[model samples]
Target: MRRGRIDYRMQRRAVLAEVRSGVRSVGDACDAHPDLVRAATHVGAPAREPCPLCGEDDLRLVTYVFDRKAPANRGGRAVPRESLARQHERYGDLTVYTVEVCTACHWHHLVESFQLVTRDTAVG
Candidate 1:
């Protein structure tokens, strides 16, 4: 079982619905920060789907892990997926946020957020 896991698929669907229904403009939906866009190009992993808004095949996913208890330089950085286990081991308690980015259109969204807890540090 996933401990402290939270999925944001529903929220993603809602935002897509609004964009599709014309309630929210495409500009608003695709407004990703410059830093995020840069990360998408440099460190992002390939996403399964194409850009939902632009229909480009430039979608990527970037995982950012943050731990308030960690030193300022150690927290709030994008880490590779392959090293997540190592990160959890080092941080003990961390919050991870996965973001989907379309480098083509600068579109981005929060894919999911979850808490990572080491076995020793997790509360029952």
Candidate 2:
């Protein structure tokens, strides 16, 4: 259940626009962390679109999950997209974050986030 979802397309567009208009350098826009690139290579889902910054076909979508009901809500883990349903069943009121990454250029940005319903909160 993707409830309370927030889309970050506008922010992504703004960042891209800044890169294009010389406000932000390509290095600034494409500098994904090492761990993130590793996650994108291993667990990321192939995106439908190419890398917006580099025009490469290596864009991937990585998903991370955190328990909203837990204290501090820290230490989120990167999860494969295929296992989201099982993950949702295991955690109550979870927060899921999805990011777009380009394995080629190291570009990355948060694309969307939403709450996952546990068994208790699941609707029929």
Candidate 3:
């Protein structure tokens, strides 16, 4: 794939989602994708869905993706900043959303949103 051919959005979404869920350690996330932490910290989160970074509500969903393996076509993928687009082709179907919140504080700007379609994974 060409340099720009890779999908950075999906890559970052996968990484960020893992961090937000606590499934991936911050240190591990950083170690695995050094650029991810830096990019995430710098770029800020999206404005849709709940603010994953600060858990705020006033946000907007910008980028929405559909889970590739989703049985009903509704799946969410966590993505980080640095690993965007080029992370992997397997992430083709993962849905990623970029949101922006309306908080005066510059600290809280954007967040990522994900949805669980199935009951088993949604609640579990």
- Using TM-score as the measure, name the better of candidate 2 and candidate 3: 2
Give the alpha carbon lDDT tens digit for every residue of 9-107 in model 2.
Answer: 999999999999999999999999999999999999999999998899999999999988777846888999888888877876688999999999999
- Candidate 1: residue 47 lDDT (0-100): 95
Best by TM-score: 2
**What's each prediction's TM-score?**
0.87, 0.90, 0.26
lDDT of 2: 0.91
Q: Pick the candidate with the highest lDDT.
A: 2
Q: How far is candidate 2 from the true structure (C-alpha RMSD, Å)?
A: 2.7
lDDT of 1 by residue, 1-124 (tens): 1256777889889998999999999999999999999988888899998998899999999999898487777748887777788987786678888999999998899988877766545456
Give the Å error, residue 25, model 3: 37
Off by over 4 Å in 1: 71-75, 120-124
* RMSD versus native structure for model 3: 13.9
Lowest-sum lDDT 10-residue window in model 1: 115-124
Tens-digit lDDT track of model 3 for 1-124 = 2111233456557767887799876555334233333334445454445544445563333333445465774554344433445333545434455534323211222244443222223232
Q: How far does residue 43 in candidate 2 sit from its true spot (Å)? A: 0.4
Sorting all predicted structures by lDDT, with the top scorer first, yields: 2, 1, 3
**TM-score, model 2 to reference:** 0.90
